[model samples]
Target: MRPLIIFILFYLLCIQVQAKTLQKTVNENTISFDYTWQDHSHKTQTLSFSLPKKLINNKYRRFKRYDKDKAMNHIYKALLEQASSYNPREVRVQFKQQYSQLSYTIKSKSEKKINEVEQKLKQLENKTYLDFLKQHHYIEFNTPWAGTKIKPDHKNFVIEGVDYLEPVTQAIRESISVKKPRVLINFVLSWLQSIPYSTLESRTESSGLGYYPPIRVIAQNIGDCDSKMTLMSAIIKKIYPRLSQSLIYLPQHALIGFQLPTLKTDKYTTINGLHYILAEPVGPAKYPLSEIADSSIGYIDAKSYFHEII
Candidate 1:
């Protein structure tokens, strides 16, 4: 009986020590992780961020099954949300089981630099507007005038614009050397917004029978929602051939969507096992890459398309 009692006490002491060690680990607030990847420019970069212990504990307890992959995905999703707020042009996250590690890469054009370019653009706005008018030979015509009616095969038109937008593609590549898709999309958005907005009826003078090619839209410096979205889609397809993109038809309006690895918000749709976030191209109002306007939500009827440059 004496030997048994001694054994039981020793076991209890060991249990207490183990529990204390676990408590110490759980109380730690941060986990250090190393991230390494190549940027859009093919330059290798490394960075780090603190993974919150609280998040891990909460997810672990809730998942109960404690799937490492699921837990890692949650971590990646959180990291994505945090990174996106800073408006990185591109971000990719991966998990490696060999080291029980997470790695990610971000390519972001500095906001300060973009802002400086914006200032310069603003300074030249008046001159640019005048130049556009003079070069395009602006003409004002009556709205809804009986212009020639032509039914556009929308898909074919968009596909054909791939070859037609070479000049615009060249201009984009030259102006912004960063090849990050999101940043390039934003750059396109800014350029489209710079053009004055006009309805198809107003510009074409043929109500409900007006569709212009992407190049025509650019040269004229005016277009409706669909025209701008078509231009954006063409430019994106030309530049990032591998990235998945789509045209979302919403009520009488149109928007663009791009497939991303993971999206935290409900404002997305899945296509062929990939997630795509909605982006507005017809904006005097600036919207982020995947964000839609408040008025445009819940009434959306989206369609997905994958265009190959070949």
Candidate 2:
């Protein structure tokens, strides 16, 4: 009986030790995990953990240390991967305690569409930028417009504005047999021109200080020069992730430019040794790709400068 009792106690001790080792492993490696949902209200929630090393691994297993920025990126990618499988209504994420006990619910139609666009993007992941442009030039995008009243700060307007993804996706889906890169660009230019022009001053007077989100611009069917350029820029970046692009700012006007294989004009700007063809997005005035407005050309030549979008 004494021997049997000792054996039972030893077994229990082993099991407890195993559990502690597992918990220690988890607590020492994981930094944080995030949960995001896409429904009518776009929402994201993050749970943080303190650990010595980053637990997340890329496909190559290259990243093995915890970096706050890199970890956030990993979490976002993970959420995007999971979100693709859900319908465009309500998306949910739940994490077990062992994994970092977290739950996120996002309700936003626009967010769902964005996830769908991302899924489509995965199909072209292996293709080169030029190849992707050639293959998807004529794909038509069909996403309903959704407007937000929130004002965008300068930084928000430039780098982080993802609301444009949905409409841009829709535009890609709606594209017709556009084989050439120039022709594809024209399609986006035409779409921007179709939106009615509203000046920043006038928009601010009525709606207070805020830039329209790209999706909002589509829903409202009107935008200022900055808003229009922002929307166009977002679309261009989505299509050509590897291309060098920038924002050109004049005294009172803003435009975007892209680096192509060949230069169409000497009137271009160079950033990081890449020449970008200046393209105007604000129009009722028809300007071809790489053609700046005649009035703005001199201003651009004299006082315009470029800001690289990274």
Candidate 3:
């Protein structure tokens, strides 16, 4: 009896996984995606879009893995290589933990020698920091977003991911009969919301990559708040090239806001004399423009969230 119950649970889990798999039909010329989702009105809608196969092959041929320890090791090796380039007998550099913080210690035969070595190390460290981020395809960010400690390169995701999605954005634009800003934005949101929602793991976790870039999110048909926001930002940018945008990070969730006309009842934030009407694009729960998850309202109302211009 116990075995039967366990087997049933396993079967249910398998069904859930299979259901989330995106249905795509690939041909020599293009890859077509068919999606069905419910709109804010609780009405079911279907969308079909296709991407030129060549675009996928040429533009997003690889998915990058984000591993903090691996990246740190690479940086450490670089530092050691730089240090070895100096006369080992004259200068030595060591990394040590003091009061629960790690810092560099320099040793030399004389104070003058140590000072010289320190200057060189400083220059190398600065250059290495930027190089490591580039090599790892990450951008540095600091935020208090929930379930996050190491900053994921969300800026890189937004800026870079936007380029590959023009074909998709154009397809969406053509599908919508009404070209109104709200209408198009809501349509995009509903499509994203319908995709399987996967919780973003912490970067510190060794088991999974915490953040998914926009293209990866679409390819996998699963995303959390940050990933969806990144995709939405890219789509909105393509649709309205001149539109100003910002990404809002709440304690455990994320949302996007656009610099556009607003009404008295709209939820918005002001930056540099511009109004950004906030929109919640991360949904299995439909939130139309000017609406956000109830969980996020306290953070938004109290202004206790981080905001970044994209």
Candidate 4:
């Protein structure tokens, strides 16, 4: 009786990406488990699973495995579907066992339409977007960590305020001798830059802005890709935004493309040929969306997997 009660309680905590974790205690042929559930849905749910003194799972039936979140979800859905058929007005469930009869309750909210379940699923998915970006090379880099900048396509990119960007090629003219690639500051600048990354966690409104300048960006250093690209276009409007091939890549090898752009870039006009100056992030390079990624690991791209204008 106690084991049966435990099975039912353990099943409830398996939903919403919570893993179905079970612990088993053994004595002779009997196996008893007190499955403790935590780390999901904001509560502690526990139950005990016991097998008949003789029937043990030593047969290696991995289907009985419980660590999988998917399996936990399946168990949860099964429990809910089974529970739904019981009419609260018609029946009451109570059990007596030495381990103590623990009661389970399905809150009124759980009985809501399937759409509510979908909403919960969406919330879980939404929580994963930024994490996804961090695990993939979502942004692209043009050159290796240490290399001369590649000349881009011919075109002028636009800047709303700055009419004409004085062009300057990347030249190590000042330092004819490259430093022997010494590790400056005990680690990479990424560890020390204190660069702030952001998303629309809190925004009053959103809309389209055609073109902007770097002054605001230099000042606030915050804005969406819309303004980011707009500023990129403005800076390089005199150049071109290449469509066929990636305009940039890192020594590690990566790429992305801009359509035709037209701009006042810090460098030569028409760098993109269509005037779209490079719109890469001021700090870290973002990978293109085409790349397969898992943000459960740390990777980055300006392109968002969640959804975006570009």
RMSD of each: 28.7, 28.3, 4.2, 27.3
lDDT for every model? 0.53, 0.51, 0.76, 0.29
Task: Supply the TM-score for candidate 4.
Answer: 0.22
Ranking by lDDT: 3, 1, 2, 4
Report the lDDT tens digits of candidate 4 across residue range 1-310: 6998888777664342222334446777655544343311223434443444432332111211112244234434444454556566543223222332222333333445344444554454444432332222122113324332212111112322224322200111111234221111011111111122233211111111211123333223343332343333333332322232223322222222343332332111122343322223322333222222233112223321111112
Which run of 10 residues does model 1 get worst, by summed lDDT?
59-68
Candidate 4 segments exceeding 4 Å error: 1-164, 167-196, 200-205, 208-213, 239-256, 259-310
- Candidate 3 minimal-lDDT segment of 10 residues: 201-210
Which ranges in model 2 have alpha carbons more than 4 Å from their true place?
1-155, 162-164, 202-210, 264-267
User: lDDT tens string, model 2, 1-310?
Assistant: 6999999999998566334322223345443222121111122211122322331232112311122243334444555565566664554433322243223444545776657555554443323322422222111111112222211233234444444364344445454365466666766675566455777643222222334545455534567776788777776666665766776655456778778766555356666787777777877665668777777787656544435463
Q: Which candidate is the best by TM-score?
A: 3
TM-score of 1: 0.45
**Better model by lDDT, 1 or 2?**
1
State which candidate has the highest lDDT.
3
Candidate 3 residue pairs in backbone clash = 146-251
Compose the digit string of candidate 3's lDDT tens values, residues 1-310: 6999999999998567446435688888998887766688987767777777776666544645565566656666777788778787888888754443335889888999889888887887668767876766665555554343445567666777677787778778887899999899988988888787888665433223646678777766778888899899988987887889999877667889999899998988777788899898777788888887778888877878777887
